[model samples]
Target: MDSGEKRLNELGYKQELRREMTLFKTFAISFSTMTLFTGIIPLYGSSLLYAGPASLVWGWVVVSFFTWFVGLAMAEICSSFPTTGSLYFWAAHLASPKWGPFASWCCAWLETIGLIAGMGTQAYAGSQTLQSIILLCTGTNKDGGYFAPKWLFLCMYIGLTIIWAVLNTFALEVIAFIDIISMWWQVAGGLVIIIMLPLVALTTQSASYVFTHFEMSPKATGISSKPYAVILSFLVSQYSLYGYDSAAHLTEETKGADKAGPIAILSSINLGSFFQHSETSYDFSYLYDTSNETAGAFVPAQILYDAFHGRYHNSTGAIILLFVIWGSFFFGGLSVTTSAARVVYALSRDKGIPFSSIWRQLHPKHKVPSNAVWLCAAICIILGLPILKVNVVFTAITSICTIGWVGGYAVPIFARMVMAEQKFNAGPFYLGKASRPICLIAFLWICYTCSVFLLPTFYPISWDNFNYAPVALGVGLGLIMLWWLLDARKWFTGPVRNIDNENGKV
Candidate 1:
């Protein structure tokens, strides 16, 4: 057995996942999960409407800096405990034995829910992108295009979710190969859009406008508070910078994971932030000149259409570019599903969730978590069901996605500071003296962003514009707590040791 497998045995896991992923492919998994196209495009208009180009540019910088602190803290812990359970496992291993189980359980539910909801958010956005593509092809603009009903959009979301689940059930090598391709696709495609937008645009805004502009139209977004609106705009950046934790969740399947896993987590954040900044900096420069109505329908798509149309009087170029973004979403969802399945498998191995036996089972031939893949798909479909009744559900879903992920990330980091200050072990990627400071800052930022997203986005909040993230998260946690009080506390200890490691150490 290799050193990674040896480490797994020491940690009480059986090395069930194939450790075939290389450094590059491991990075690719996280890279794809935070795809710029998947995260930024859906919320571009809302961000613009909130604080204009400055928020997209400067707000991204602020969010990226703090997110890097979070990533660094996570990387340190990930190196010490390179398991598929990731954050929860790290919390359990690092916390005091008396409180370890409870800490682990809390992180597990938060991270697992965040991951599955991450997939739901991506697939839902992909469905809308597909709808935009069809309308563009049929000679329809946002004003006269074929608008899909809520039910139809939900159907589209379901179709995309199923496709991602099916793809994830393939062989391990196939998934790794697809992830490498996805990384390149996002990098290359993003650069193309950044460079091509200026080349084809009828006119572009100056750097001052792109970097210094700020606006908060009370009439447009129903908020008059500039600071609050700017904070709300940070969602675009926070959402785009997430999903890098997929690296930690996939470490069991990664070679040299003690080092590579941490690198993947850190590098994905750096690279994703760079690309988002560059692309949005350019897209917004041109977007302000485009019609407001067109930009409102879908900012990125309409920007591409207007750019190419102004130069060539045809949207063929825009349509082709849209396909590139759609491809990014397709690959991003697949990677997310892969990561979610691994989380499910790890959680079930310890009886953390209902139906542990089934979810923990892997396919005989492919050795993939086929059951878990479908379970994630099913849950995502259920989450998307609310989209059928109201369009504002999209706002709520995105809010929950941000809150779930940010809160999940903060728990383990906070635990490391308060519970494992001296007890925590360092691995290949230790931060040494810098670890505590980084963890403290990360935790603080997470607390701020979580609370900010819960506040109402619209000023005069009615049922239509209500931000339901707080409600959804409250109910989900309440149910989990209810289960704990009734039954889980009796038996659910965190990170069950599957292997007989009499001489092994964690």
Candidate 2:
């Protein structure tokens, strides 16, 4: 057996997943899932609406700094407990025996549901990007543009979900190879936009405007407080930076996972943050420089159309660039589906999911979690169907993406901090003396962001403008606790070991 398989045996799991992914492929999964193009493009105009250019630029710097601490802490824990179950598995092993089961259960459900929600959100955003492309190709937003109805968007979302699920059901090697391609697509495509924008734009914003502009009027963001608006704007950066933990979730299929998994998590953040910071600056600057007719539309696609039209008087350039952005969402959703399926399979392997036997099963030939892939697809589709009419519900559902993911991540880091005296094994990527301090900062940042996410984004809140994130989170947490009290508490004792723990034998 290889060293990875031997490590699995020590963790009491027989090696089942094919460890074909090398370090680059492993990093690709995390980087593609955290696609900066998908994250920044859709939210760029809206983020500028919050606190102008300063929030988009400086908020990223601030959030990225703290997010590095978060990634560092997660990487340290992942280095020690390199498992597909990831956050929850680390929680069970790191926490006290008395609290292990409950802690793991919460983390598992949070992480699992969070990932499904993220997949749905990414696909949904891709569908929206598709609609925006259609609008731009036909005409400008103010002219005879085609505005897709809600039903059309939902259909596109379902179609994308099916495509992602089918792709994820392929063998690990196939998906890992695609992930590498996706990494390049995001990197090269992003570079094209970053370089091409300032070149072709009819005008450009001054440096002072790009860095120092601040707008927090009651008319601008529905709030008058600069501090609150700035805090609310951090969501754009925080949301984009997350889902990097996909590396840890795929460790079972990764060679030299104990080292590769931790490295992927941190590298994804470092690389993604660098590109996003640069791109966000350019995107915001371009938006400001566009004509008032386009900038007032408050949509990135509209800005692109206006920019290209000013120089070339054609929409084809804008159309092609919009497709580039759409590709980011496409590849991003695929990687998220891969990560979500792994989470479901790992939880089911321990009998944590409702239908553990079915979800835990890998394809006989491909060795992929085929059933779990479909399970995620079905859940995301169901979650998405509401967008046909009650569109606000989609916003509410996507809100869980950030809170649930970071909440799951924080649990284990918090557990490790509280249980510092426990017998812990450091992996090759150990942090040495800075571990606890990093964990503390990471945990606190998670807490602060979670709280901020729950607050209302718009003032004078009503049914339409209310931030229902807290409601969605509360209901989900309540159901998990209720299920634990009623059913899972009886038999669910954290992760199940298929192999003997002491002797590493079946």
Could you list the CA RMSD of all candidates, in the order they appear? Answer: 2.7, 2.7
Clashes by residue pair, model 2: none
Angstrom error of the Cα, residue 230, model 1: value is: 1.2
Error of 1 at 205 (Å): 0.9
Tens-digit lDDT track of model 1 for 3-46: 66777788888888788889899899899998777444536336
TM-score, per-candidate, Cα-based = 0.94, 0.94
Q: Evaluate model 2: give its TM-score.
A: 0.94
Off by over 4 Å in 1: 38-45, 142-144, 276-295, 420-422, 503-506
Candidate 2 C-alpha lDDT tens digits along 94-191: 98999999999999998987899998878877886788788776775467677677888889999999999998888888778888988998988888
